[model samples]
Target: MTTKNLLVELFVEELPPKALKKLGDAFASVLCEQLRTQGLASASSVATAYASPRRLAAHVTHVRSKAQDQAVLQKLMPVSVGLTADGQATPALLKKLASLGADVSDPAAAVAALKRQGQGKAEALFYDSLVKGVTLDVGLQKALDEAIRQLPIPKVMTYQLDTDCGMPHFLPGWTSVHFVRPAHGLVALHGDTVVPVKALGLTAGNATQGHRFEAAKTPVVIAHADAYAQTLRDDGAVIASFAERRGEIARQLAARAAEVGGGCRPIEDDALLDEVTALVERPNVLVCQFEPEFLEVPQECLILTMKANQKYFPLLDAQGKLTNKFLVVSNISPADPSAVIGGNERVVRPRLADAKFFFDQDRKRPLESRVLGLAKVVYHNKLGSQGERVERVSAIARAIAQQLGGEALARQADQAALLAKADLLTDMVGEFPELQGIMGGYYARHDGLGNDIAEAIEDHYKPRFAGDELPRNPVGVCVALADKLETLVGMFGIGNLPSGDKDPFALRRHALGVVRMLIEKDLPLDLGQILATSAEVFGERVFTSGPMPSETPEGSIGIGSIGVKIDPETIPKVRDFIYDRLSGSLREQGYSAQEVDAVLALRPQRLSEVARRLAAVRTFAALPEAPALAAANKRVGNILKKADAEVQPVVRPELLKEPAETALHAALEQVASVADAAWADGDYTANLKALAALKGPVDAFFDQVMVNADDPALKANRLGLLATLHQAMNRVADLSRLAA
Candidate 1:
C-alpha cells in the first residue's frame, strides 16, 4: 500500500506560556496515536510536533489516505447453547448470526460455516468477518477531536460559532464552543490535498495567519504536508518548532554575552528559558542596562525583580556578581534596533528603582525592631501568632545548641531564630515572600551583627526546595533544625498531617529537611529526643488533646490552639514518617530497596550512621558465606518467636549438650568479640565481614541441633544460643532481609 505524509495544525490566540509545550506535545501524540489505532497510520510512521506562541502543529509520515481492511474473529456464545447435540442450527444461533449481518438467509449454511472449539462449558462459537476500511477524511476528524479533548490546557474558554461551524458569532442562534483559546484556523492535509476536517468550530484549511505583526506574508500557505515547517518559516517570519526557537534564543544570548567582554554571562536558569521560549515565535535578543545606583541593592533583590517582574536575564561578571546590564528576548527585530533596546531599558528602570527603594527603606529599622510586628501577622490560627512560634523555636534551638555546641553557640542561635521571621514584615519581603530569609540576612549585617548571626538568619530557611544547599555554619544548622522541628512537632501534635499530595503545611518537606541535615551533616542528635523536646516546649495541652484539635487559642489548656487533637500514637507516627522520607531519599541516592529496608527495619536512632550501615550490608551480601548466614538468621528469628518463654541472649554454657550447639556457641563468642571491636571503631564493613566466620557453625547448628528439644532446659539453652547469634548478625543490618 502507498502512503503520504500528513499535517495538522491549530491556530489560536496565544497559549499560556507555562502550558504551551505540554499542550503541543500532547496534541501531536494523541492525534498520531488515534490515527495508528484506526489503521490509517502504520508502525513505520513518525510524528513530529511543532508549537509556537500562537500555533500547535504536527506532521506524521507513512500515514495512509485510507486504512486497510481488517479480518476480525469475534466470539459468539457457548458451543452447547449455539448448536444442538447433532450440530444442527438452533433458533437462537440463527438470530445471533442475523444480528451480525452474516448470510442468515441461508441459516443452515451459516451455522455450518461457524467454528467451535474448547471442551464442555468452555467451548464457544466464533465468527470470522472482514471489516471495511476507514477513509482519511473520517479518520482525521476523529483524531483531531480526540487530540483537542486530551490537551493539558491550563484553563478553557467558551465562545460562540455560527450555524456553518466556521465563524465566531454572538447571536442568539449561535452554538457554544469551548477550548483553550478561540481557535481561528485548523489545517489537515494528506500530501498536497486538504482533508476536510473541523475542530473547535473551525474548518481545516491550507492558510494560517503567522506572527501577529512581523509576518512576510498575510496568510502563510502550506503547500504540502512535508513543506509545512519550511514554508511557514520563510513566509510567516516565525520559527514553527519550539525546540528550534529556544535553541536560537540561547545561541543569541551566549553570542551577545561574549561580545560584551569582561567575561560577562547571562545567569543560567532553565525555567526562565522555557517560559521565554513559549512567549515568542521569533526571538530577538537585545542588550539593555539600568542605572548603576540600582546595583547598590542586594543583587538577589535586583535579579529577582528583573526575572520575576520583567522576564529579563540579568548578566553576571566573572565573580558571579550582578552587573547593570541585562539581556531581553524581544519578539521583533527592526532595521535600526535602537528603538526596541531603548523601550526595554525605559520599562525596567522603574522596577529596579522600586527594589532599591524597598531595600533602603527596610534597612532603617533593625530586624529586632520588626520582631514585634510579627505578633500582628497570623502565623496560623491554630499555632498562635508568629511571635509565639518564634519563642518556641528559640527554646528548641537553645536545647539543640547546648548538645552540639556550647553557651556561645546557643546564644547566637537563639538570637538568629528570634530575628528570622522578622523580615516577613519588611516591604521587600512583603512584596516577595520568597525573599524572607534572604532579606533578613542583609538587614542583620546593616545592624552591626557579625556574619555568623547574619548568615544564620539568612539560612534559617535553607533548603526551601529539593537539591537546595543546607545551612552554612553551625548556628544556621542549629536554627534551621529548630525551625523545621518546631513546625513538624506542632503540626503533627495537633494532627495537621499531610495526606497524599495536599501538603498545605509542607510537613513532608519539613521532615525530609530534618533527615537530610542529620544524615548529611553527621549530627549526633537523637531524632526522637529532638521531637520530644519540641513537644515539651508546647507543654501538656497539645499532646493530651483528643484525636482532633480543640479549635481554641493555645496556652489556655486548649488542645485546639496548638493545632489538632492528637492521640498517643502521634509521636510514633511522626517518627515513622521521618524514616519513610529517609528511605525514599536513600533510594534516590542509588541504594537498593532491600538494603534500605533491612537497615531501616532496626530503627537506627542516629541517622548519621545509616549510610555506613547500608555500605556494610552491600559488602556482606556479596560474601560467599552471606546466603547461608542470612538463611540461618531467618530460621533463628522464627525459632525465637515461637518459643513459649522469652529467649534471652544469655546462654548457660553447661547446658550446651549437642556437639553442633557447642561448636556454634564457641564460634559466636569469637566472632562477637571481633565484631564488637569493629563496631566500636565505626568500621561497619569490617564488623559485618567478621560474621563470615559463623556461617559454617550456624548452618551446622540449625541442621543437627533441634531447637525444640523435649527437655525444657536444653531447648531454652539452644534458643538462647540462637538469640545471641541473631543479635550479633543484626548489629549493622538485619541480615535475614537479604534472604531470598
Candidate 2:
C-alpha cells in the first residue's frame, strides 16, 4: 500500500484557555483512532497534536490512501428454510440473494456454491462476498466528522456562516453551525495534495491563518502534510505546539527571574502556567511591580488576585515569601516592552486594591464577633445553621481534647472550633471562598488571640485533599478529627449516603481525612468512640421529621429543621463507611488486598494499630508455615460456625481422648500465652510470627480428628481445641482471610 502523512487543522475564534489542551489532544487522538479502525492507518502510525490560541491541528504518519479490500463470510439461514427437499433454491433464498446484489439468474448454481455450517439443531448455509475498499476522500470525511462530534468542548457556540450565492451547494444567504467556537477555516492535506474533506460548514483547504497580530504572512499556505508545524513557525510567527509554547514560557520565566538576581523565582502553579500558555501564541515574559503597601495584606490574598484575575505569576523570595514584583506573559514581543509592562501593572492595581480593602474591612471586627453572624447563615436545612454546627463541633472537639490532653489543650481546641466557620461571614472569605480558614486565622491574630488558638483555627481544615499536610499542633488535630466525624455521623444518620459517584457532601474525603489523621498522627483515640460522640452531638438534628432538605430558601438566613428521626442502625453504617475508606486507602498505599482484608476483618478500634497489624501480617505471610496455618484456621472457623451449640475456647484436658488433640492442646497453651504477652506489649509482628510453630500440631489434629463426632462431649472438646487455635492465630489479623 502507498502511504503518506495526513494533516488536518481547524481555525476558529479564541477557545476557552483551560479546555484548549484537552480539546486538542482529544481531536487528534479520536481522528487517528478512527482512521486506524478503518484500516487506513497502520498500528505503528504516530500522531502529533498542535494547538495554539486560534487553531487545533493534528499530523498522523503512515496513513494509506485507501483501505484494502476484505473477503467476508456471512451466514444466510438454515438449510431447511433456504432450500426445498430436493436442494433447489426457495423463493425466500432468491429474494435474499437479490437484496445482497447476488446474480439470481442461475439459482441452482448459486445454491450449489453455498457452504454448509452446523447450527444448534440443523445445518445453515453461508455466503461469501468481496467488500470494496474505501477511498481516502470518503474515509477522511467520516473521520473528520466524527472527530468534530466527539471534542470535549466545555460549551458550544451557535453561529451562522456566510454563503457563496453562486455556488451550487448554497441553499440560502447563511447556514447555522454549532461548534466550540465559530469556525473560520479548515485545512486537510494528504502528502502534498488537498484531501477535499468538509466539516463545520467549511470546505477543507491547504491554508490556515496564524497569529492574529504577529504573523509574518496572512493565510499561510501549508506546503505538505509533514511541514505544518515548521511552516506555521517560519511564515506565521506562531509556535503551533501547546507543549512547546508552555516550555518556552517556562524557560523565559526562569531566565527573567534569574536576571532579577535577588534570590527571586516565579511562584510554581501548573494550572496557572497551562492557562497562560493557552492564552498566548508567542509568550514574552516581562517584569511588573505593585506598591509595597499592598504587601501588608496576606500574601495569599495578593497572589490569588494576581493569578486568578490578571493571569500573572507573583515572584517569591528565598524564604518563600511573596514580593511586590510579578511576572507577566504577553502574546506580543516588541523592541521596547515598557508599554506592555505598564499596561499589565495598571490593570492589576485595582484587583489588588479590592483584596486589600476586603482584608482591611474584615479585620475591623474580630473573628469572635462574627460568631453571631453565622446564626443568620444556613449550613443545611436539616442540620440547622452554621452557628448550630459550630456548637456541635465545639463540643466534640473539647471532648476529644480532654481525652488526648488536659484541660488546657481542650480549651484551645474548643475556642478554635467555635470560630472556625465564623470566617464564612467575613468580607474577605465572602469574596474568595478558598480563603475561609486562612482569613479566620488572620482575624484571630488581629483580635489578640494567642498563637495556639489562631494556628489551630488555620489548621482545622488541614488535609483538604489526599497527600495534603495535616494539622501542625495537637489542638488542630482534635478539631479537624471532630469536624470530619461530625459530618460523617450526621449525614449517615439522616440517610444521605453517597451512591455511585454522587458524593455531593464529600463524605468520602472527610472519612479519609479522619483516617489519615488518626493513623499518621499515631493518636490512640478509638474510631468507634469518636463516631458515637459525634453522633450524640447531633442530638435530635438527625431525627428531624421531613424529607432531607436539598436546598436552602433564597434570601432566607435562619436555620430550618427537618422533622425526621435518626435510625439506630445508622451508627454501624457510619462505622462500616469509615472502614471501607480505610481499606481502599491502605491498598493504594501498596498493601495487597489480602493483607488489608485480613487486618481490617478484626475491625480494630485504634486506627494507629492498623498499620502495625498490616506490617505484621506481611511478615507472617512470608513464613513457610503461613499457608498451612491459614488453611487450618479456616477449617477451625467453619467447624465452630456449624456446631449446633455455642463452642467456647475453653477445653477440658481429660476429654481430649485422641493423641493429636492432646498434642494440639499443649501447643495452643504455650503459643497463646507468648502471643498474648507480645500483643499486650504492642509487638504485633512478633505476636503473629509466634503462631508459625503451631502448623505441625494444627495439621495433625485436623487430619486425624472428627470435629462432628457422634459423642457430644468428644465433639465439643474437639471444637474447643480448634477454637483455641483460631484465637491464637488471629491476634493481629484474621488468618482465615489469608487462606486461598
Candidate 3:
C-alpha cells in the first residue's frame, strides 16, 4: 500500500478562545488514533494540530491509502454435527455455510472445504477465509465521523443548515446539526486527492475560507495534503498554525514594548497570551495608551480590566510597575495602524472611567460602615450569614492573639477580622469578586486606620492557594490563622466535608491553608488547642448532623469515623484530618515514610518542632548502632505490651538480681538524664544521638536476661528497666518504627 500525508480541517464561525487549544489537540489525537486502530496509519505517524478562532485542522504524516488484507479462521461447529455416517454434508452444515456467504452449491465440496481438529471431548470444524482490505476513503470517513463525535467541546451549538453549505449528503431542504460552531466549509485531502467525507451537514472539499476581512482571495485552495498550511498562509491572509501565530505575537509584543523605551515589557501571564492567540489568526500587535491619571487606581484593578475586559496586554517598567501604555493584538494588518491604535484607546476609556468612579465613590464611606451590609448576604444555609461568620472569626482571632501576642496583637486582630469581609459589600468587589480582600485594604486606609489594621485586613486571606505567600506581619498572621480555622471548623461541624474530587466547600484548600501557615510561619501554636478553642466559639449546638460517612476519606484518618454527618463528637476528627494532611506534606518534602511515621505518631504539640524532630531522626538513623537499637526498641515495646498487668515503669535496684539488669538500669540513669535534658531544651538531634551511647548495654541486657521470669518481682523489675530504656530512646521519635 502507498502512503502519503493527510490533511483535514473544519471551517466554522469563531470558536471559543479558551477552548480552542484543547479542541485542536483533542481532534488531531483522536483522528490519528482511529487511523492507527483501523490499520490505515502506523505507530510512527506524526500528527500536527492547528487551531484558530475560526478553524481546527490536523495534518497527519505517513497515512496509508488502504489497509492490508488479513487471513481469518473461524470455528464453524462440532465435527459430529457437520459429518454423518456416510460423510455427506448435513442439512445444518449447508444452512450455516449459506449464512456465511460461502460457496454451498455442492454439498460434498463444501464438506471437504472445512478442516477438522480432534480433541478429547469434542472436535470442531474450522473455516478459513481471505478478507479484502479497506480503502482509505471508507477508513477516513469512519475516522472523521468518530473524531467529530468525541471532541471535548466546552459547549455544543445547534444550528440549521441550508443548501448554500453545499452538503451533498442532504437534500435541497434545510437540516439541523449540532457542533461547537456552525460549519460553512470542510476540507479533507489525501496527497493530491480529495476525500469525499461528510460531517456536520457539510461535504469535504479542497477549498476553505480564511480571514473574514483581509484575505487575498475569497476561497483559499489547498493543492495537496502537504501544501495546506503554506497555501492557507500565502493566499488566505491568515497564520494557520496556532503556535507559529502565538510566537509571532509574543515577538511583536516584546519588540513594541522595547520601542516604547523606559525598559518596558508586557505583563507575564500565559493564560492571557493563549486567549489572545486564539482570538486572532494573523496577529498585528500595536501599542495603545490610556490616560496617565487612570493609574491612580490600584494597578491590579487597571491591569485586570485591560487583560480580562479588553483582551489587551498592559506594559510594565523595569521596576515591575504598570505604565500608561498597553499593547493590542489586532487581527487585521493595515498600511497605517494609527486608526487601530486610536480606536482601541477610545474603547478602553469608559472601562477605566467606570473603575475610577467606583474607586472614588467607594472611598467616601468607611469599611467599618459596610460591616452591616454583610448581615443580609448568605454564606451558607446551615452556617449563618457572613455577618455571623465574621463574629465567630473575630472571637477566634482574639483567643489566638492572646496566646501568641497578648492584648496588643489581640486588639489589632479583632479589628482586622471584623472588617475583613466588609469589602464583599463594596461596589468594586460587587463588579469583580476577585477583588474582595484587596478593596478592603484600600478602604481601611481611607478610613484613617493604622498600617497594622490595613495590612491585616488585606492579608487575612493570605496563603489562599498552594505556594502563595503568607501574611506580612504578626497581626496579619493572627487574623489569617483565625479566618481559616473558622471556615474549617464551621464546615466540618456542618458535616460538609470534601468527597472525592468534589470539594464544593473548598474544605481541602482551607485545611491546607492552616497547615501552611502553622508550618511555614513557624508559629509556636498548638493545632489541637487552637482547633478546640475555635470549635468552642460555635458552642455545643453547632454540630447539627451525625458522624462522618465511612465512604469519605475522613473515616480512615486515625480517629473513629462512622457515616459523615454533623455531630458534636466529630469535633475530634479535625486533629486526625490536619495530621493526615501534614503527613502527606512531609512525604512530598522528601522525608521517608518510616521517618515521617515515626515522628508524627507521637502527635507533637508544637508544629515548629516537627522539622527539628525529623532532622534529628534522619541523623540518628545514620548511626552504626541504629539498627540494633531500633530492633531492641521493637522487642521492648512488645514485652511491655504483653505485660500480665500494667507493669509500672519503675526500676527497683534492690530487686535487680542479674548483672545484665543491673548494668542496663545504671546505663539509663547515665544516658536518660542527658537525653531528657536535651529534649527539654529543644535540642532533638542531641536527644536522639545520646541514645546511641546505650546500644551496648541494651544488647547485653536482651542477650543475657529473660524478660518473663518465673518470679513476678524479677519479671517486673526487668520490664520496668526496659520501660525506662524505651522512654529514653523514643523521646525524639518512635525508634521502634525504624525497625524493618
In angstroms, the error of model 3 at 57 is 1.5
What candidate 2 gets wrong by more than 4 Å, as runs, is 119-121, 165-175, 541-561
Steric clash pairs (candidate 2): 543-564, 543-565, 544-562, 544-563, 544-564, 545-562, 545-563, 545-564, 546-563
Q: Please give the RMSD to the true structure for each candidate, in Å.
A: 3.2, 2.8, 6.5
* Per-model TM against the reference: 0.95, 0.96, 0.88
lDDT of each: 0.89, 0.88, 0.87
lDDT tens per residue, model 3, 113-217 = 888887944888888877777888999999999988999989999888776766466664556789999988899999989999888877888999878889888
Clashing pairs in 3: 545-566, 546-565, 546-566, 547-563, 547-564, 547-565, 548-563, 548-564, 549-563, 549-564
List model 1 lDDT by residue over 1-740, tens digit each. Answer: 89999999999889899888899899999999999999999877899999998999999999998899988888989988888898887889888888888998886789878887788899999999888899999999999999999999888998776555644553535577799888888888899999999887778889998888888998999989999988888898889999999899999999889989899999999889999999998999999998998889999999998999889999999999999999999999888899998999999999988898899899888999988876666666666677778988999999999999999899999999999899999999998888989999999999999999999999998778899999999999999999999898888876788988899988888989999899899999998888888877775432222222233356555344343443467778889999999999999999998899889999998999999999999999999999988888888888888888877998999999889999999998998889999999999999999999998888888789888889988888888888999999999998898988
Tens digit of per-residue lDDT, candidate 2, span 143-242: 9999999999999998766665233575654667799998889999999999988887788889999888888889899999999999998889899999
Better of 1 and 3 by TM-score: 1
TM-score of 2: 0.96
